[model samples]
Target: MQVSSWRKAAITASFLTLAASTANAAAGPLDPTQGGAGGRIIRVTTLAKDGPGSLKEAVEAKGPRVVVFEVGGNIDLGRDVLTIAEPYLTIAGQTAPSPGITIIRGGIDLKGHDVILSHIRVMTGADGKPHFSDWEADAFSSVAAHHVLVEHCSFLWALDENMSASGPRFTGKTLAEWRANTSHDVVFRDNLAAEGLAFSSHPKGEHSKGSLIHDNATNITFYRNVFAHNVERSPLVKGGAQVLMVNNLIYDPGHRAVHYNLMNLEWTGHPYVTGEITAVGNVMRGGNSTDADLPFLTIGGDGDLKYYGQDNRAVDRFGKALPMFGRYGETKARILQQKAPLRSVTGIPVLPSGEVETSVLQTAGARPWDRAPDDIRVLFFVAEGRGEIIDDEHQVGNGYPKAAETRASFNPAAWNLDTMTPRSGRYPGDQTGPQEKLSPRDAAMRQGGV
Candidate 1:
């Protein structure tokens, strides 16, 4: 059936609403007596012009509420809407929400203290050019604001039409500086961040920073987040702050995954001296156009960098290993200690077909095998090329005499090679010359010596 984009979107929203309602019902009715004044959930969908006040006003009316910005339809943060203030409130997105509330011509000033913002997209004006407003000094001029939570949101540049030639380039500087000093107790997780500039412009530049648990911000946990197609640098940890970065997929089309540096405390007027950064189980891939000289990750000055179970797919522009700081043992230990067992949060059933089976059986004396458990494995016999088992238990080896010999000796009958077959190999069950001669033990099995 052909479904229009709008219809598809509507269907998705309906499904989400139904799922949420069912979940709430399963949890039972909320007790008004619990958790101080029972957390309130406020929905914001009306346009600011249609209504007199901004979405912030709606949240304030609820009194210590959880304001969910239900962006069912398109809405804009016009020039007049300048600031938002709400204490102990959560600004969440609904129904394909894109940064529910955006600060356009005039930057947004966040005054609400200890605010939790999630699933909301934050972007600049639509103008193609940079609107160089002092975001730190003017836009977000909150004095007492702290403990901000930003998750599952997309932070990017404004549209081209909203930009002007005279405006400042949509460089990542303003935001980077803002995070360096202003925000505290900030957690950014499962969010995508991309710098607007090109690689040539700021080859070694740094972008946003904060309290990342598993990724960028300090005291923040970033798990299963994708950071890809980023220009310039990713997160630059300044000063001596500890950040836990794990299980994140960080790829830079232009630069490295992360850069750690010792803050020139004297020059930058910062108090901290070194950054203690730990990274684990992260997949770091580089862009094709990137210079071969750079490493997938880098650390500067006298800072610590530790990595464990990390996979670096792309070599940096330089031939040297990605610059990582810290002791390897300590980093691995931290990752092991912090690792949590996977749990089913949604109560989804596991499908039998979805699970993959991997097991290997080898003859008595064979070359030591080096293979990951997850990799596919195949059993090959030279006389048959490859054989098939009739059932889970290899009661029947249907191919050549070598196949019968293998099944008899290897008891289990099934063997996983954990190796990719060459394209030129003969078809399964067809006898062919061995690409590489097998070990004496393997040769005996092929000759039916088992």
Candidate 2:
């Protein structure tokens, strides 16, 4: 009775919160400005090298920096991984000459505190070229990092997962080490993670993953993003405390949209800890192929897991709500469907159900910096097959910037193609890299300017 009463009260409060605002509520971790260097701006200049104005150099630079781009191009990292070990950094990919700035071949690792990554595109194996390591890394990964934000980016064709938040494996370590390895206060928002892969170390048979929040990662919020075309682990919720997935658009994933589990059972070696996920105002559409009828959420492992969902919608291709089911019988399903656990989340923004679809579509990935506002509004519909694709790439003063481009198209027809093999014609958008013109400002920025 008390739980029912609590759920009713919380539902009322959530509706009231939603009614109070009809705006696109900003999501994700607080900006990197919450701490460090009082927020300084560092402009990125290089495309092919790792020196001054280069993203690699920016990662190695000390202190908090709002790392902006003055050029747009791909950085070909043969097998090198960019590691950010400093505190208080913000990679402002939005400040580039265009939204198509900074496509990376090798992946990035966020192993620091108070970091924000935005507006960049990460293509793990560019142009279907293999990495020297046989494509064994994610586009973006974190370990024990705190107060991080990843937004307005696109990650595709990763050798492993597209994006992941995790820490070290527990090898029967002490409590201090365990505590030290836990990731907390992380948020992934307004991004696109598509066509993630499964490779060595990731379960091979039935689990190619998208985003993973591994065991011991905590306080994560996934808000208003697109998770499309992955087999499993579309933001898998492993053992953690306080995870919130809200207002996300998951379209056509090959398996369950969200999995609550100890993902890698062999590696975790656990007296498994309980994991919690609170889902709200989210949407999922089953794939057009064999995965069309999969469950939206699944509970795996025997851990004491908790799922509290409210005001969520799942649809098929025809816009019909899909059946929501629990793996266990009625009693377990009732607990998973309740809304009481999310009442404790106060002060965070609550998104209304109506706003989620448009918000996610219009702002999910990189957009042109100077395109008309109206065009930007309609771009998602065009990308989903309404109008013709626009050409925005341009030549700087005399010549084009020398960055690699994916130049791929969005092909929903290829959703069922086996991504495991090395065929380039799989997903929508650029399969190799982004194909946008370098901003004219790139010339000024590249000449030791800006």
Candidate 3:
């Protein structure tokens, strides 16, 4: 029996109502309550046009320190990776003059424990042409890190995964070392990860991804983030512990949506048992003509990868639920009701997936006070591949040439921007629905001045 889109909508509507009520009952900032608070404030006072202070030294400083920025601007790491190995650290870009700080041309590697990073922007910038060594770079990577919270950040134009939480990668590391490097208790919330990503380090450039969670990364949560303009892995979860992907907004994902897999020899080079993922209250929508007609779920390997889909929503241009897709003949009517084992991880918040678009639009990327008109312009330009018109004034990062680079022929900026214009208000992009209810920290910041 064929299912009508309207019937799917009705089921989704009921689920959304329930989820919304649950979210409404709970209200607070999703802060990393355990680390870096009440720590020593290490103020980064310089906008170092090129070297220390704002660039590398402060970011790489060791120990339980709160790294706060005094100035707001760009820091280009030039092919260098800023490795944060210190535990109990708080990198607060919100403390900058305008919370508009951006890290460009390089990536941030979190190899520490109990770290909290908020209101920061990490971009490879527009000039990251795909090289065979692209895999060496990523916007943000967590390696065996624990109790980390990455919130209200912007990650763009990554040659590899935009924001990834992976175990020890294969780089001549011993198997025991790889097993020892396990990431756990990480949370990525209210962030924007967008645009022009490469598949792997190789020149394929075919599979642009937003975020990837690889083997042994356990108990990770992605909540209320905007995964925009990338292809696959707007999280692809491989073998891991429990993963909760809740209330995320995927706008114009080019190839596919959330995928889960167990690892075999192809990628991990080892046989491994997979973990379970509960994808709830997420929304995926097509925003451009270039967006592909892709599956909502892709399962690979035979590693017991289980998925529990509840209250998720997908819409085409006309705002209808997408046709469902799963392996074999297990085709369901609505993609939202896919069945697998249902479980929960403690400390993971269950916000309504219905509010994902609104919540992300309100809080993702850099804080509103820090962004200038030029910053907004750059975001639009890079996402759409309109690199030719972008100049130094509009560029936020320090990558050379400062022009948008796209692997795809067709650009979608002109069309997507026309449909959605960001405005100065309580939300990020034009107030799409009821003013998003702000978290306590967000409300305090906005009331204090923006």
Candidate 4:
């Protein structure tokens, strides 16, 4: 089901140019109406998976609600993925005390619009299950959902894609309608997606995908994130998918790193709408477990891909350079060159590729001031050239931390309801900088700061 390659066309109209000083400028390009603005604050008071005062309860509550954490600890979902269908929601994990909320043995299925999630950790670990035995899930997912901005979160130990944006590719009658129906206006920034479990519960035998921007999903942005220890997808863009990938640090890729593929079979009777990826100032460094000679971006399938790549760095284990692009599957499928990205998305904070590694280590992931052990290991491994793509979470350090659940009251007046940012610019229950209480592991990592 392969379609012949097409010639490059003129660049489309711009999306939106974002300014940080604007009344509503989120981390990503989407401006105004960040999430759950002026909505009821739903407090999570329990570490239980679903009962009253639980995260699932807060997520499932009807109408627009802002979810804040009263308890800080791990919420075990018993290997089940919690589905989120409510709209206009904001999950403010940063409101928790000390070590913030972490969801273990489960994942988040975000199917809501106008949502924002920040400072949350999700570890969909292999729960001691046999190799390739049972079901698998991603640490976070947004399918057919729009107006999302997921910031400063950590997604780890997933048997599938760590974080993904996807939906029915052929949902509407026309291509424009279809693209609108799929996931759009979504942003993933300042996050860590690492160690997506390879060869574990995924029936696919080897599935450690960083993320997948599925076909027809448009207006997606991945900014200043760390994609570490994942085999591939880091992430893959499919047909008609338009993405702005900027200032991201990709460490220890198994086979691929930013790729675009439009499966002809998936497009069957539908037209082969080309995918576009604007990659700017990203760094890709191979690690111990990386596949040899893996390129930074690869093209496959049958549909032509429109690409605009600038200032991206790709290097092998010893700092030797690697090819920036490759072709596979349908080799004849051409890559259409673009001079610039669409104008729709504007406020691109593209750092110099050389500085991406440092920036990500310092700021990426949930609660960088208090990184989870696994996240600490992942960041250090990226820095020190250690760590590998593993099949199980237990192979590394303690699979999940067991912190005593602590309660705290969230004062909504102290936060900007739109962005969930504290009015005082300082988070609650935090000492000054890296000088605060540091665990031995954290102390060692933060010689200056992690």
Tens digit of per-residue lDDT, candidate 1, span 191-295: 444323231111232222211221122343343344434443345444343454444544443444465554243224333333344454454544443434555
Provide C-alpha RMSD values for all models, in order: 21.6, 13.8, 12.7, 8.7
Give one digit per residue, the lDDT tens place, for model 4 in 204-252: 7888999999899988888878999999999999988989888888999
lDDT tens per residue, model 3, 195-218: 644443435545467788877566
TM-score of each: 0.48, 0.70, 0.70, 0.89
2 versus 4: better TM-score goes to? 4
lDDT of 2 by residue, 316-345 (tens): 766667765434222222224554855344
Task: Report the Cα lDDT for residue 4, model 4.
Answer: 9
Q: lDDT value for candidate 1?
A: 0.33
- List candidate 4 stretches off by more than 4 Å: 1-28, 31-33, 343-345, 429-450
Top-TM-score structure, candidate number = 4
Q: Lowest-lDDT window of 10 residues in candidate 3?
A: 415-424
TM accuracy, model 4 = 0.89
Off by over 4 Å in 2: 1-39, 126-133, 169-180, 198-207, 267-269, 326-338, 343-345, 368-450
- Model 4 clash pairs are 14-343, 14-344, 15-343, 15-344, 16-344
Model 3 regions lying over 4 Å from their true place: 1-33, 49-52, 126-136, 169-180, 198-204, 266-271, 289-292, 327-351, 372-450
Return the TM-score for candidate 2, rounded to 2 decimals: 0.70
Error of 4 at 393 (Å): 0.3
